[model samples]
Target: MNHHDPLLEQLNQLISEGRNPDTLHIDTASTLDIVTAINTEDHKVAPAVAACLPDIARAVDYIADALQNGGRLIYTGAGTSGRLGILDAVECRPTFSVPDTLVVGVIAGGKTAIEHAVEGAEDDHGQGALDLADIRLSAHDVVVGLSASGRTPYVTGALAYARQTGCKTIGVACSPNTPVLQAADVAICPLVGPEALTGSTRMKSGTAQKLVLNMLSTATMIKQGKTYQNLMVDVNATNHKLKARARRIVMQATDCDEATATDALQQADQQAKLAILLVLTGLDVESARTLLSQQNGYLRHALKAHC
Candidate 1:
């Protein structure tokens, strides 16, 4: 065993890999005490995320501008980071009625890695570059690299490839000044400190990344006219719950009765934004839809035009 190995040194230097002094006595404490310690540490995650708001906002602007101009938002990572990226990407379709192609998630070991661990997948730096290349990455795309460790080869490689393609790159990690952050055009590092369980980035670091990813996708969608009056106007009502929600959104947006909302939604092909416009403006479905399209799908703008 080599004592001065660089990998060993790197791990030793990582704050995420360091033991938590707050939880040092957990082994001998009661279960309640142990959970309390974990809870205390979890409370620190939000403020850490809040500290990176400026950087996160900058990343959002880059992603939103690129997407508005016919670009995609690409998330690439390994392990837990990769899984979080995929979760955020898959959600955009149903949440905002956006095409899946508009937001893609590239995991280190491919789709198989999502449900099961793929050993050595994150260690291959070149594979990350290849995965983005396979997707036909374009200059208009914005690539976000997720790596809690801040030094994952897979994330760094993807960011490097994105930069090479002249795409805007955003790096998200929980550690400061690491390769993943440095490689990004817009770096968002939320220092959540060491985990309650030593070296388990799946905990605090993962939570921070999840928060940031949520902001990135949600804010970008809002900027893209996917919402109306704080409602998910473009929400894909594929099931009963969302269908009910869509009707409710129409009612809320137009202050119409439930029956009126249902009728407008039926006439407007279940599009909440269109339904709301029909109820508020008394325009026919086609006319309301034309108005929405003219306003770039912004319900507020469409409503103002009718006024």
Candidate 2:
């Protein structure tokens, strides 16, 4: 089969596909020279992400609203972008003590696609809509589409279906002026320029996408009162390390000794935020729980009310 499609050629015209003049001679350069060239390109990723802060902030607000209303935040993409979405979704549960259903990741080819490439999966627009449908996406949800090229048919289809279903949509893309952006209610385009090795977007573009996902999840959780003064107050102490961290969080929040913090955590039924409230406000476990509940788990707000 002849693989020379005009659309592919047009896609190659995208900035992500443009070859970097700086790395043209990398093949003949020393190892240090190649590293330096790639490092120079990598330096552009942060500022590119910084340029899209407004869009990212908008996304965070949208996600926080959806989550607060009992709706899930869904991320859809293909390839490296898909993996990044899943990475962010999986981390949210342990990091913020949220349920897995609250944040979801839908890759183009399903769970099997996480480890192996599913041929032509990204090209299947209908499957994209089907994937979201399978999740029972609703009007209260927010769907974020991740596409390095900004034209993945899978993501574009998801965004369209999400809009049709009255779900809010956000698009994160590395290239400027693409379909994913047009399909989304809010577009976050981090123009990281071309890859050091031509069309390899998994490097710089992947880094930018990861950064945006970090901001989206972290900021949304912060808005939801998951953190208490920069500490992971809602952290799930499901493991030894996390339990230690939870204890430390209580200690840090109330300036209490380790023994007192540990005792408070135990008295509060191993709940970090409640323990902190108990220690800081000198309230019983039930009163601390009530105050935290009244403030929607915002430690600072609960502290202000009792202190």
lDDT of all the models against the reference? 0.93, 0.93
- Per-candidate TM-score against the hidden true structure: 0.98, 0.97
Best by TM-score: 1
For candidate 1, what is the lDDT? 0.93
1-307 per-residue lDDT for model 2 (tens digits): 7779888786787888888888999899999999999999999999999989888998999999998898999999999999999999999999999999999999999999999999999999988899999999999999999999998999999999999999999999987889999999999999999999988989999999999999999999999999988999999998899999999999998889999999999998778999988888888888889988899888889999986
Write model 1 residue lDDT over 217-265, tens digit each, in one string: 9999999999986899999989999999999998888888999999998
User: In candidate 1, how many Å is residue 20 off?
Assistant: 1.0
Candidate 2 Cα lDDT to native: 0.93
Which portions of model 1 show Cα errors greater than 4 Å?
Answer: none
Off by over 4 Å in 2: 1-4
Local error of candidate 1 at residue 15 (angstroms): 1.4
